[model samples]
Target: MKLKGSMWSCIGLATLLMAGCDKSPPISTAEEQPSAPKKQVAFQPDWVPKALGSGNFEVCLSNEAEENGVKDLILPVGMMFDSWGHMTGSLRDSKAFDGEGTSGFGKSDQYALALTARVHLTSDRPCAITQAQAVTHQGFRYRHETVPASLHYNFSAGGLYLNKKGGITNDMKGPAGDAAQIGLLSGTPISDVGDVYRATEDL
Candidate 1:
């Protein structure tokens, strides 16, 4: 009986020792590494134009803000349209500016379907701060030799370059092609030129 009790005691001690050995140590996590900083791009005004319909379009005015100080001063002054409404075609100079519809507007009236260049907006509503829109014209002729373009009605919407300081430079990569011209006039957004037209019609 004494031998048997001693044997059981020894077995219990062995079992407890085995159980302790089977237990796992607590897991620990490593410290996290710090993240790198992000870089910023500059805003330089680069105007581009795109057509929506036969006589409708949208323009995008991009101002790339560079980290470097070298920049360009783009002007806003352009052809001043008069009471005669939106002129058409390659007709550069029209007849004597009429009184009512007799006022005049001027720009490099290329033979393309739409005005060549775009300008930036002045207002804030409808998200038109650094935005651009299409310029309209009538009576201009087009040919297959160049890209197709839409027409501009009397009430067509467009962008106006206000506070322009840069010379006319065609930076097509920014928005549209280089065929368009940048104006030298300074003005505001003519919201009444018609309602905002969608950038893309086909969805």
Candidate 2:
């Protein structure tokens, strides 16, 4: 009887030890763990002509804050009616402003697109800055082309000349091939001309 009692006691202890070993550490509850909030990236402007549909847009802060700056500029400015707009750079693919709708706008119309870039906005909501918008109920078709752009003040020259102060824009990379030397400037989310894109649908 004494031996049996001792055996039972040992078995109980072993069972308890095994049970404890089998048990898992307390599992974390969802409440115990929290997740970080995501950044805001959605905002559509009414200015994008209804015809071309919508565009792939990211928060300006996304591109603006980048080390190299915007790779491609989604321009808010558009042609007259049904202006889908351009996404790359330079407004005029051609040097001849007389293409059709190019002149009247200006001769400098051939300058870099970044110099005259604009973005879209519903209202000047606290979220984003508003520029220009489409006034013409009818929008126009537009095209885009990437061109070499030199944007900066002459490190030594400064202005148009070395002594002058104001200057144009440029990418971090040195200008190569054919490029336009344009000043750095921004346009309204909406443009007066929508800065009528420098191309025409007539041809």
Candidate 3:
């Protein structure tokens, strides 16, 4: 993929979500005291990766199921953000295959899920993703794995991935074409997938 002329860098935040318990007693003063003004953080708009121009791309799914079983392939094609800081995306049903044991007859179905956004960068600023994670929303649990460097974006912190088992793997892989190809070809069982959600100093 050809990177744009703009220079990008990655900033690793120790925490994405902040939570705390108020242990101190509540103030009971009749007179209200002035409070300090809160700092206003600048808002930055998310940008579509150069590879996915206009934020449109086709999610390819190859039938890799054996000749005697049923298999399904799911992938993310669009991305969006919720009212909260959390990022979300739509899923695409790429292909489904039903193998015949002895009738020599089988069925193969192919489809695509059009998405307005498929990748969610944590920040608009340039940053390289040091980790990736596979977050399952449904179906059987699969092995987690780290994303390849080819897909890492200096501007985007992470992305989304849909597994065959009907689960979304968040920040688990880069959006690069080659990285997607590797995921499809590796045939790595979900049980043996490694964890790539943690930070990696090396790109």
* Top candidate by lDDT: 1
List where candidate 1 sits over 4 angstroms from the true fold. 1-82, 85-90, 101-160, 163-193, 196-203
* TM-score leaderboard ranking: 3, 2, 1
**Per-residue lDDT of candidate 1, residues 43-137 (tens digit):** 11221222222222232222221211213333232322112223232111122111123122332332112222433332121112222233233
lDDT of 2 at 60: 25
Better of 2 and 3 by lDDT: 2
Clash statistics: count for each candidate:
42, 25, 19
Model 3, which residues run further than 4 Å from truth?
A: 1-23, 29-158, 175-203
lDDT (C-alpha) at residue 12 in model 3: 17
Q: What lDDT does candidate 3 reach at residue 196?
A: 29
Using TM-score as the measure, which candidate wins? 3
lDDT per residue, candidate 3, 12-102, as tens digits? 1212222134445776887888886543332222322122222122222222222212133233342211011111111111111111111
Tens digit of per-residue lDDT, candidate 2, span 1-203: 01212343688899999888888776787678576643322223332222211222111212121232323333222211111112222211111112222211223322222222244322121123332222211112123232211111010000111011222211222211011112111121222222322432222
For candidate 3, the TM-score is 0.21
